[model samples]
Target: MPYPLNHWLATVGFGLAFCILASGNRLRAEEVDFVRDIRPLLAQKCFTCHGPDEGTRESGLRLDLADGLFGELESGAQGIVPSDPQQSELYQRLVADEDLRMPPLDSGQRLTSDQIGLIRRWIEQGASYRSHWSFEPLDPTPPAEVEAEDWVENQVDRFVLAKLAREGIAVSPAAPPQTLVRRLYFDLIGLPPTAEQVDAFVADRDPNAYEQWVDRLLASPAFGEHWARRWLDLARYADSDGDLGDKLRPNAFGYRDWVIQAINADMPFDQFTIEQIAGDLLPQATLAQKTATGFHRNGLKNTEAGSDQELDRVVRTVDRISTVGSVWLGLTVGCAECHSHKFDPLSHRQFFQMYAFFDNVEDVDLKTGHGKVTVATIAETKQRRETFVHLRGDFRQPGEKVRPAAPEFLHAFEPRSGKPDRLDFAYWLVDGDNPLTARTTVNRYWMHLFGRGLVDTVDNLGVSGEAPTHPRLLDWLAQELMRQGWSRKRLIKLIVMSATYRQSSQPRADLVDRDPQNRLLARQARFRLDAEGVRDVALRTSGLLDHRIGGPSVRPALSADITAYSRNRDWVVSEGGDRYRRGMYILYRRATPYPMLQIFDAPDTTASCARRDRSNSPLQALTLLNDPVFVECAQHAACYSDWQTDVDWIPQAFRRFLSRDPSAAELARLRVFYDHQRQTLAEFTEAQVRALCGESFAVASADQHDLREQAARYLIYRCLLNLDETITRE
Candidate 1:
């Protein structure tokens, strides 16, 4: 049966009243800040039609800019009149007739009365404008004080606690040592701790035990393997060229390995970004840098008969533009392709300007056949090419010529004397003044550690994206990234060490109603393990894992039916230890991913995927029970230790699988299960026993009794592995 949902709800409900009573002190209305309160409201309600795009600017009014908002509109009325809501055209339109609403009746956006009141109060208190919170230069301000000063362990905790205090929400206490250690292991290395390791940490009296554990895990090679999976999602890393035939890119594994190595070496984040974007363009670039350019080569390529090659090339360029925007800038710059960005500050011209940086990459047609990486390494030509705006995102319909440039919205980092190239464009991204890169990078890292980001819409931090729940906290992290010289490891360590990150995942009863999403950071989030992590945990617990780091992607056993999708290629399952490599090394065919990973929500790798969906289904349970690999794991785990009695075995099994000993009640239920399975195995016929043992039953009839005993043990192990807690990271 599925884990009971009400169990968590009941816990959350118990904490609600206490939270409200504790956080009763609220901020007054007069202290409203424009960047925090007003800009978000205006960006959501008015920016789409009136702010950025000149072509789409309605009635020659722009609320995004101070000059535009305070100046008279084409209708000879100021959008905002200082200290007078009656005279402010913007305020009047918000409360205007339904047909004459500022967003208009059909726009599907309407300001609530409370929101209108906030806007009115702002105008009444001398209307002021500030740069968009994300675009402003990051300020390294100390965290604001909170009532729970004793709870603060770092600046992160201070920010989190300050927000919770304002919301009248009390922070959840630190999770138990056992739970904290397990959480740290999975969060850092994407693997569960061994029972001995877990016990040692729990018993350690050292105050810095957790920090030491975190540092050790961070330094482990596995750290790169865990984080590389995240970067692969953004890189759209794949083993095959995605199309009807599902052709393979054998050397794509080179780029995957590079990522793992780069992360493991703790390469500065700024250099990491630069290398991936224009590594080949670097003067006297190393082989590693050239391989880094494989990020661009990771995009899907079409080689089907009679395909439009020119159009396909344009699509590839656009893919790079869109992916870079989402991965680095946290904006959907692609939205401005056809016209102008309706909601963001990017213009149609600016979109092409960014596109121009990637336009000059020499197109190479290297498709030999399926299962081969044609151009494993990228080579950029020194020759430059002019780019034109595709009038409606159509290559044939060219409009205006454009030079390479960053988006104009940031108002930072313009090209020097001559036209900037890809390297210059990349340098500009990390040049300290550009606001979105640091914030976007840190936000994604935060999301990987926590279940949610400070800004919920990780890929889109523009006007249309969800406003940050803790804007100041997000800025603090962004500034820290730059201050630490863009060292991803340092930033990650700072976040993980915070007391806020150490909070218990268990929710207070009151939190369910007030902060259902846990946006206020009242508690840590408990989520099911990612597809790779789930598989890794089982492998580690069962003693079947191959700890070898990286190499060519392994082709795990897949049924012939699934491999048939690749018409021109055949998959040969890797032999011996290769079959048990980490899931990140599993061969990822875009058209047909490994069935187990696909079912568990692994990205298809057709495009940049910022976050993956976590889904649970009966099929997942069935797969664990019946899949051959999982069955093999269960059988191995069952035979791993020789326990003298059920009492010893059951507790040991719990420790191996869950890093915790079973309770008396759990032991009682498992004892009954073990007894029932043994009883059933004793009655099984010879053929049935052979089927249960599969190919491993090569011994003669003399060992039949021993085989049946092992089969019974397999049944018990399967049950343990399928437990909800076994596959979840709490």
Candidate 2:
């Protein structure tokens, strides 16, 4: 049976202690930690009606605050009296009669008997509250020592091993050289390795060969193209306006190209953040910086006649605020627009204060001729407009006026010279004293590399978010990111070089039962490639990639049925090498994305998507088997000439596509498949062979016998492309 949600969350939140408890082991009196044990339980069960939002709080009481819970309540009783569980109303209400129980039956939440016992014991010991983990300042101490001295490759490994030691689990050994090299190639560049490159690294005996290979891949131009796709998800980038018309925007490619160039140059992340947010407001800003301001212009715009212009503009403003909150601080600040935040300590007034910063941006629609595109950009006027709270998120009814400011719950933003604006907002985010920005950014990078973040909810680090399994390690990484001058490349290099990153993705038989999610870092994780990475691997392995840097987005051929789904579609397929560019450069229409990417779970570009879901389904399998792109890739892969005999091709094909030679069993299985296909092709008549090879084959060759040979080889290529290992990043 599957574990309960609270039980699983407790296991993730408390690390080893919860593991022991869930295994039915007895817990000592000294092991109960209020922050780790009691806080999450209250936040999940009791906080919704009794916590941060003042409008919904019950009985003039708040359980989330220390003073409110421990002090006297309006009912002439204390909710939580230190060292006295019998007198504490908090404990009494939990074990009360069904009708008077906390989290009343209608609320669809109930505390288990064990949970009640835990609370009673916690209050009996003394109810001590610690600050929420993410809100505390980052810890700057070194990692704790571990028992496995020789296993220590860096500070990252020390922290990971120390946790495993506490759980009585051992770390998995390093993966073989073939698996290591393949993992490095996909992780760093988002492409598969060439057979020759794979062989060279496998044969190299030097101890530093792996590090040298990492440096080489990081410096490659493809590295920028690969990483840029990740940032575009947060930017909400699309080639067309989303609603009714879905009209195209031609100049959005400028922002896309800017991201690639910035990452390739190893731009300091602080400067990168500043440029994207306030580049247009800077005095004498460069053309590239102005283009960077296009980040805000990427939101959806309604161009249809008779639309509500004022309401549309207000929605755009909310999108910017919500995106910034999620992308920078990992908070769902948007939840406060209608009322005070129900979970985090953000009031409705603070939401409008941040909205004031974006209200002055001059972005109005321009009329253009049919099929022509116009650039959407940021331009500010001399006078800034005042911002107000929309009563219950209604644009028609406005409440109290507000000036520009950051959220009050975080570090205070004190201006040094002039009135605070968006530029000031950007600087305040990256300031060392503020806690969330660096930690959030490093967590995102960790997710990209390790298949999961320390805090699994990458977009929210608020009260509603999951607690980090290793809180100290997350703080250390955040401090290290700031100490390195906010250099993204430097931080990435350190993570990839760590011993924790080098562990085998294969699970240990002993630990899988205890920690299936691998939150304790007992082993590496294996996951399917992202949508872009999946397509790019097939293109590179088949030698069909263009390798050209960014220019304009490409329109590859799509099925007629997919094109007809859109009402105002005008997709003209790009000619020549443009059709073969990397998947990131494919034109993305918000209403109707390319079918292959949509099937593979690419973001819809409607909001800020910090992470994309990896789904496995029959449609994905069918697309790889029948899509024109994959079929063309297969044909191209079959045309290469390297093997001497018909059977000699199988192992070489495996090495080229999978980065390793096939085993004896796999080779024997594939040889039978190859022979069956060749015999089927030979039996076909001349006219049947011509029909099987499309019109493109007619132009290339008229010989029926040769076409039969190539078609048989194409069958093998198609099968290789469909293997699970080919698309996974293990």
Candidate 3:
């Protein structure tokens, strides 16, 4: 049977109050911010018919630009008249008759009354238009002081508290020591803290106890293991060449290990990016540097019997351009591949210009360790290939040739030579003047720490993307990242040490009607663990995890049905200890993924995944109770220590799985459940007991009392692991 929904919900404290609190009751800011308020509305509703694309723009009017919006329309009428809603054709048509509406009768789109009012108020306020929030350079001005000086721990807290003060919402108090320690462990190392570690932290009297723990975890090798999974998702790192045949990429793990090592070493962000983009082009490049170039080769490839090889190469090139655009610049440049972007400033010619940098690179398997191992990497071709605009994104319809360069809308790209290459492009990406890279990078790390980023839409920071909830805070953090020598560890340490990150995640009844999404950062966010993180927690708690550092990927045991999906059908489960490695080392076959990981929302690795979807489904509950790995975890965790010898087994189990002691009522109810399960197990047959408890329980004993008690304890452990709190990170 699936785990009881009510039982899980009750444990996690996400009942009716949470549902009502999550209702859509968002309150707008007192003063209208042009980028935050007006741009999104224009981009979503007005821009489609009157924005960027010249071909589809109606009446030769562009609402996206100020000159266009304030200029006379084709009908010789002012499109927008500042401070006069009465004279503005924009506002006039918005409230016009159905037949003469701005969107027209057949457009099937209409501005709501509230929206129309906002436009009127905006016009009455001078119809201001600011540059897109993300395009502007980082603001060097320090954060403004907040009234709640006592609550501030750092600049991050100052910004958050200032926002909360403006919203008339009080910041939630600092989380309890128990909650903080567990949250820090999971956030930093992606593992649960042992009971002893939790006890020590709680008992420590030193004021630097929390900061010390942060330093220790950041220094731990596990930090790399935990953080690399996030980058690999954006890199689309996979074990197989994804397509119908699904052939394996044997040397892919070399790049994966390089990332782990680089992050563990706290490699500067600028150098990290430079190496991956054009490491092989560096003078006297080392083997490790060449492996870093594998970032470009992680995309899908086709090697079928009948295929368009040239087109396949072109597709890979397109993937490279799109990946760089999304990962570094946070722009949807792919939209401009066939035509000019209808939202952002990316143009068709500019997209090809960016593509030209990657066009000359070709994949090569580099031999390492005296030819015993191969690393998948890229190198510049002996004869560079010219880049042409793929007319309508079709390789057969090539248009004008373009030279390598950065987007014109961004900072100038000055190559060292007359002909620029990937190396020059890499330098261009990390250049101080490029607005997107530092901000986008800082946002990525922020999203991983908090449940959401400062800018909620992480992948897109263009005009259409959501504006930063705290624009000043975002810029402050970005500036700090660059000033600190681009050290990710230092930035992460600074964030976790901040009072803003350490706030209790409990829902506020007062803010229920005000801040539904918690964009104001009145409290920290509570969310479920990432899919791989869920498995890592189970393995670590069960004492089955191999904490060894990086190496080649391993094939964990999969059901025959899952294995059948692979073309080779040669999945041999790793021997003994290798089977218990962390989920990061699991072979990510694109066509045939590991069942448990995929069920928990693991990305398929076909494209850049900025953020993963966290889903709650009955299948997830069922998997925890029935899947072989999780079942084994429950049995081992329960039977690892002698439960019968301990009177406080329930409390012990709670700490082991949840890193906390149960409440009086929670302990009482769990004890009753244990007693009921003992009685149920007493009547079960030996075969049935063995099936439920596994070999770890030793059900063959002549003493039936022991079997009953062991089976009951095993079931309780399963129950604990299945609770919503077990997988959730509060």
Candidate 4:
């Protein structure tokens, strides 16, 4: 190669020109943290072509790095001629004729007016480049202290309370004890405490009682069910697909139950993620491990007519990438599918590299293994689903091919195996240095306990994410999670055992005026029972709950119209079948989700739902007051006591349903109601009263069920079903 004197002269001139400028204004221009500023912009706008793909280039332009942008291309054109915006090819492409948009066809979301201004100013101001913030090695010590020393509950509280102080907000007061119990119970076990359970805890003289409860709940089998459901939703648990109505994955629940068992077992979170992603790949993967792989296979399928089986399966696999990222990484990597991420530190090419990890495996029906093949944990029977850059997220239009690689922004740590695949994919995700996996898992666990994540959005924690209310708190939890060997149960117990977790929900009048949302947690967040918790309580109190454990999903009795699911749907609410007797698992059969559940807020099975919104609606009232399940449970509940024998029926009923001793006032009102209802029913035959409770005459109970004796019991059932205590953590 000839060293040209002219080239050397030009390079020296360029270096001198930059030095002259630096001499005039030596203070470095606003420190450009790539992860904080530039990486997000580059990642969002230019990573697809000018990025990691060594395979292809369009029009000889690549904006991936400063050298790539400033150096000459094969065509002798440069992306940018620094300090010459008019001469720069890069600027021209950005503000190009719509027909030649730099992002290319159909990748809309061109740079914002402000964004364009930033690029123009930076380029004109001598465009220096830097590393992404996340890629920089971590600081072992916490950053300088923030605010009020007294306000800081822990080092975590110090960070968060400081942020609040800066915003002129104050942390909320401790929540009331009732609300605290409800919150803790649901947080730990996905269920609520009985009224009696609440009272006992409130009366306990022992300070250790709450701590013991948290421990026991974590150990309980029900704890697995509660935590398992969260993981499953992320896993996309579903049992059927294809034209033959719903093709049942008869044993799909096995995976669901497996997750429950794992959580209850307090398996380390690192091992937990490894098992699901590469469980079947383990040298000694047990039957349980193989079933855990079902988590990957749990996503829903579109089995309708004319569907492209292979293509659909591929889309599902890609979606799996998005799900895995959001659920585990707390990042929105999905945005990079077509071009680049517009607001985060991930390039489109890096996305494809990650995509390559899951590219090779195929999806086939577990049932037929015929017809339209589907891709999934197919990585199991063979290899994990393979990755490929789906052009603009479309299957048929092939673009440049890519092999698996981690996002470029994560330069600090790379996957262990030189080759990228699902197992390597699994490894990179939970690697100790990886920032997101530990953070995401801990955030979810926190959200479950506190009713809000320290990072409230829970799923999105990228450039677009909300600044964490308690950055130190979240980091502390993450450190503790890993410190405990990634044991989820240990992390959960630690959070619950914290002084913040046990604080009362009742707001101090002065504090209430000070803090509104209670981001500071002057006390715990008061929580309303979720649909599952609410339904479970009603059944539990009324003596109607079917406690049989794990199998398939449940399908509570529904009116024929709801069951028929069509224009002329019949309204047939059945009571005689096992559907009413099986546990929550056996209640399956998609056409009709138990009506009670639907009204209370169960998400549609058609998609994934991480949070169920708590809403108080008129429909909730109607369902409780009139539903056959409620009526039946109330009847049975009344019968369980000494309605006509040893004790007063109404008071006994009150004790069983409300778990309260019952006031004289409540008993008197029930006595009046019983006399009137019995008189009205007495006029009718025995069949008439029997039919009223949604039961057959003489088919179940032979007595009038002691209406006088049971009236208080029915009242209690109705009251408990609607109690603020029954549905509330407080």
**Which candidate leads the pack in TM-score?**
3
Candidate 4 residue-wise lDDT, 38-143, digit = tens: 5557656765555644434455455555577778766566677766777777777778898866677576647887887777776776666654332333333463
Q: What's the TM for model 3?
A: 0.93
**Regions of candidate 1 where Cα sits further than 4 Å from its true position:** 1-49, 93-122, 125-128, 146-149, 363-375, 564-569, 643-646, 693-702
Go through the candidates in order and give the clash count of each: 11, 0, 0, 47
Using lDDT as the measure, what is the rank order of every candidate, best first? 3, 2, 1, 4
The lDDT leader among the candidates is 3
Model 4 ranges with Cα > 4 A deviation: 1-179, 242-245, 304-306, 363-377, 380-388, 411-418, 507-515, 566-594, 642-688, 696-705
TM-score of each: 0.91, 0.92, 0.93, 0.74
Say what the RMSD of model 4 is.
Answer: 15.3
Q: Write the per-residue lDDT of candidate 2 for residues 437-481, one digit (tens) a residue.
A: 988999999998899898889999987787787778888999999
Error of 3 at 236 (Å): 0.9
- Residues 1-730, candidate 1, lDDT per residue (tens digit)? 1232232123321111111222332223356668768877777777777767776677777877788888887778887888999998878988888777767778877888999999888887787677767877777678887777777778999888877777788888899888898998998899999999998998988988878888999999999999999999999999888986567777678788899999999999999999988888788987778778888888888988898888888899999999999899999888988888776778888999999988888644344254554446555556877799988788899989998888756856566558688888888988888889999999999988888788888988887676678778888898898889899999999998999898899967897667777888889988888898888888999898999998888977776677676442478888999988899999888877788898789988888888898776766766676666787788777665564443576788778888887777777766766677678888998788768756653332356666666666676677777777787777
TM-score of 2: 0.92
